[model samples]
Target: MFTTRPGRPPSWRRALVTGGAGFLGSHLCTRLLDAGTEVDCLDDLTTGRPGNVEHLAARPGFRFLHLDITDPCAPDAVTGPYDLVLHLAGPGAPADCRRRPLKSLDAAGLGTRTALGLADRDGARFLLVSSAEACDGRGDDGPPRSPWDDGHGDTADAPDPIGPLHTYAEAARFAEALVTAHAGARASNAGIVRLYPSYGPRMRTDDGRTLSTLIHHALAGAPLTVPGDGSRPLSVCYADDTAEGILLVAASRSVRPVDIGADPEPTVAEVARAVLGLTGSHAPLEFTDAPERRSGGPFDGRPDGRGPDTGFARELYGWVPKVSWREGLARTVTAVSGCPGPAPATTAGHGTGRWLP
Candidate 1:
């Protein structure tokens, strides 16, 4: 657990979450509603599952809007004097990126622009939920490569000047730049949150993230396919902790981007073993989402070689992850399996850095 910075946490009367139906977005929506804030959850369901927000639809002060943030009409569709606008309207999963490549680019570009505009108009605080690609904060992997050369190694394309397509990392980079530019030009109360990896309920089984894939394989009694000798440091945070960190950043008036995540240190193989133990499945390990398998294709559940940085999050908001990966993973398993979680497990791998593994 972490300490709350000395001060009153920021509160909102109402909020607008662009990707409110998505995994993390849905969590944010639920948190805001629980705080007695009116929430207008909007999503076109491009990469988001409607069922994620279905439970919240009946809750008081919750409104689900089926609208694409990239659509020109999106502006008119959202009538509001919102105090907060969380711009999380983008394809979050690797599988979604592979299936909807252009949509990823559009969300980062047009989607971010639309959300920022709405926030500025309503005089609301805005937060652009971003991926780790916003910066080379993690030095383990080199920068993105040319789209054509991605098959060689370190998958991802450079931001093309005139190309219609872009990789998810490129899209995230562009989105952060846009948010920064928006704040500079209009002096809007906006910030960007660079998320590393998070796992919990509502995660799509086919999302291709390391933990999601491992859990899926364990539950199905299938092989736990891994990548790169399964030694990558894949740290992660629980959805509940991630949601609260995001809200903390949103409440603050800082515009600088902050990294939010927490967890015990663990290698890919260790993560897989934990999943298998929890499910009580003897699923064999299979190293498949490896470098050789990247082929410049969509992201395959690989953790970016870098660890989480909680410096800004701690200094600014006094935020740190509350749940260990084991605890969070157990909750996720119970949610997915519709049964009581297995008995309490031993402590997760020792040591902590960024919140996920």
Candidate 2:
């Protein structure tokens, strides 16, 4: 359990969220602030955009740090006696990893080490925001399962930690191992939450992922690009729900990895059609012969995973994704279609103590 107040939700006095300017990281930061937590959001801004969290700059309890976790000085920069430390820093989107393969490796390897060190110093409850891709590497055909494998007491063989895995999946496997080892060796309070695809507002439509790509073209009144006839099954959790599930795992004492994602398995074409309908775009679904490699799932190395059964989370923590795809997608459409976010007059950057607009 975390610190509790009379009327406010259970919260931490101060917390650190690495990759806070990122899509999911920003949501977690916002949710924490709403529950009365003083937040220090740290990001290198490599793939993360400052504009994502710039709106929170004026909030009294919020501070943004522009620092790379892999930097040796990064830990000292975040002088937090934090009660919660979330390691969400990494090249998460498929497009990001494909373009920045080496960066992806460091974010998981060195980045995880740096974040864990910060948490150990503060004795905070540490949570690594990982992806299901770390376990499910079936390319583009199969839906993603949780690392726990239905919690049937048996899990599939994890990707070889050595090699042969894609850049992102291999890095994820390495990060999870590092967290487990940290927990045993240092007695650090740590956990991992393996997320499936999570799409919603603040999600970059230009990421070249299936959902983002479809949304991007739909918003632009262009054809919704479909690869290989678009029959592969995929599912995504709403960003808010994913954030909440992550917080649940963070607040718990269990160090075991938990999966946080949706439960639907709609085909790719269905999802694209939904995007078109939501955007009110008359664009047709343009099927492409995007060549997919044997090992990589999609042509762009994007994995099309089936949704995992969230019963484990429901049983362990009373957590379940509340947003339906229709609703989640509609909300995403509204936000991406130029919905205004919080606009702070002036905000300060904690990393450099500089004034930001």
Query: What lDDT is reached at residue 221 by model 1?
Result: 94
lDDT of 1 at 47: 62
lDDT of 2 at 90: 76
lDDT of 1 by residue, 1-357 (tens): 112345323557889999887889989999888877889988776666667877886788888777778888778878887989999987876556667778888988999999999998989989988876334353335332222345455646444534322466677778988998989999899898878678788876666677777887788899987776877666688899889889998887888777777643777898899888888999899876565323443232223444666777887678888887778878887777652232221221221211111
Candidate lDDT values, in order: 0.73, 0.76
Q: Which stretches of candidate 1 lie over 4 Å from their true place?
A: 1-9, 133-166, 292-304, 338-357
Alpha carbon lDDT at 293, candidate 2: 37
TM-score of 2: 0.84
lDDT digits (tens) for residues 1-357 of candidate 2: 376433223588899999898889999999999988999998777777777888899999899887778777777778989989999887786567776788788989999998898888888999998877554333133333434453454656544444434676778878988999989999889998888888888887766567877888888888887878788667678998899888888887778778788875677899998888888999999888855533444422124444565666788777888888888989999888873332222222335734234
List TM-scores for all candidates, in order. 0.82, 0.84
Point out where model 2 deviates above 4 Å: 4-9, 136-165, 288-305, 339-355
